[model samples]
Target: MKKTILLLSVLFLLISCGKAKNKAILQGKVENEQIAIVSKIPGKIVQLLVKEGDFVKKGDTLAILDIPEVDAKKSQAEGAVISAKAQYSMAVKGATENQLKQLEAKKMGLKEQYEFAKKSINRLSNMLKDSLVSQQTFDETFAKYQGAQAQYNAVLAEIDEARKGARIEQQTMALGQQDRAYGALQEVETANKERYVIAPQDMSIETITLNLGELALPGYTLFNGYISNSTYFRFTIPESQLSSLKKGQEISVGIPNSDKKIKGKITIIKQLGAYGNIATAYPDYELQESLFELRISPLDLDEAKDLITKTTVTLSL
Candidate 1:
């Protein structure tokens, strides 16, 4: 009777161990898709409007940067635009009334000189024909007459040009300069808008990389956090157990120490190429067996939206 009792007890213990191994609980954690907010230009943070754990929507102002250089550039561009516009206007319009009057007065003086020089040359020419004056004297008078006539003709041409405004080519060049200045001013305005750091999408702030008054470089991530409504569950299992789960399979996940049960669907079943990529820190599967990642999305996002990320949850296989 004693030997029979001992045998029966060993058999019972073996059965219990087998049942325990079969009922082993599989576990995973909640995760969310993360994003990084970066600046396109370098500047110092003048004001930080959001903090860790703050929820923000798209287009919300998250911070303000103090880029003194942009302000200076805007001023310079504005001045250039003003100067270019004045030059273009001047090119389009003829010379001012006062300027035309001054040219006219100068022309009148040159005309008088020309007439006086012409009479002196005529008299010298006649005198030379009779041997009354030297050839050198007549030549000097003729040179003076030619100089006066050239001066009068140049003045008339100058007056005509002043009335006709600038040439077509000159007007076109001035207009081009004005356009270039406007383009520069627009570029500066765009940069000035960058001073306000706006959120690209709805997200929950997890970390702020820079503090107030800290300098942020171009392409530097200033905020790091998770996108809104992006929570999902990640599980790692051995290939041997992968047959039990299929893509698009619906499953129930239970939170440990809580009564909440979340309904989720398997969306991804991919083999982990490296050990580091495994979701579980300490896997219970055989070392030789290849690990696979199972990404399950919540069927009802509202239920899982408030779940703390990276928290453990149990799955029954």
Candidate 2:
């Protein structure tokens, strides 16, 4: 009778242990999609439109930067554009009426000089033939006539060029310069618009890294927060028990100290590195086993929107 009682007690203890192990619960944390809002240009924070914990929507103005450099650059660009436009106009149009008149007057003066030099050279040639003038005198007069003739021809050519427009190649080059200047102006304008930092998406602001009047560098994150309607559950399970869960499987997660349960689908099951931290303080599996991360997305995102991030949640295997 004594032996039989001992055997019954042992059997009861064994059964209880098996039941406790089968009902093991895994602890996970609630997480949300996060983002960092950064600046593309360096500037000082002149005005902060939003504060921490403020909810913002897409296209909303979050902050305003005072970029004095942008203003100066814009002025310079405008000047460049005006200068380029004038050059382009000059190339397309011929010389002005005043300029043509000046060229014509100069041509008339050169023509008179050319005629006088021609007469002088003819007289000197005759004198040289009659031995009245030296050969040096005749040569000097000939040279003066040649110079006057060249000057008259050059002025005529200049007047003709003024009548017609600039060469096609010159016009093309001027147009290219004008385009380059315009492009620079556009670039400066785009940078000027960056002074108003706008929100890219709807989100809740968790942190403000800079204060008013602080300098924000390029690519520096000014705000950090979670995206709206992006709550999910994260769990770390050892490889020994990985077979119990699969991607796309539906599961129910429980909130600690609350009766509310969330229905979610396993979206990802990825292996974690050896140095990665496990969510649960005491994992059930052996230490030698590899760890894996399980991400479960809620069926109804609205239901999980109010869930606090990094809060403890429970899941049964």
lDDT score of model 1? 0.91
Write model 1 residue lDDT over 231-313, tens digit each, in one string: 99998888888878999999998888999899999999999999877775456777899989989999999999889999987
lDDT of 2 by residue, 207-263 (tens): 999999999999999999999989999988878778788999999999889999999
Which candidate achieves the best lDDT against the true structure? 1
> TM-scores across all candidates?
0.87, 0.85
Lowest summed lDDT window (length 10), candidate 1: 18-27
For all candidates, what are the clash counts?
0, 0
Judging by TM-score against the true structure, name the best candidate: 1
Model 2 worst lDDT window (10 residues): 274-283
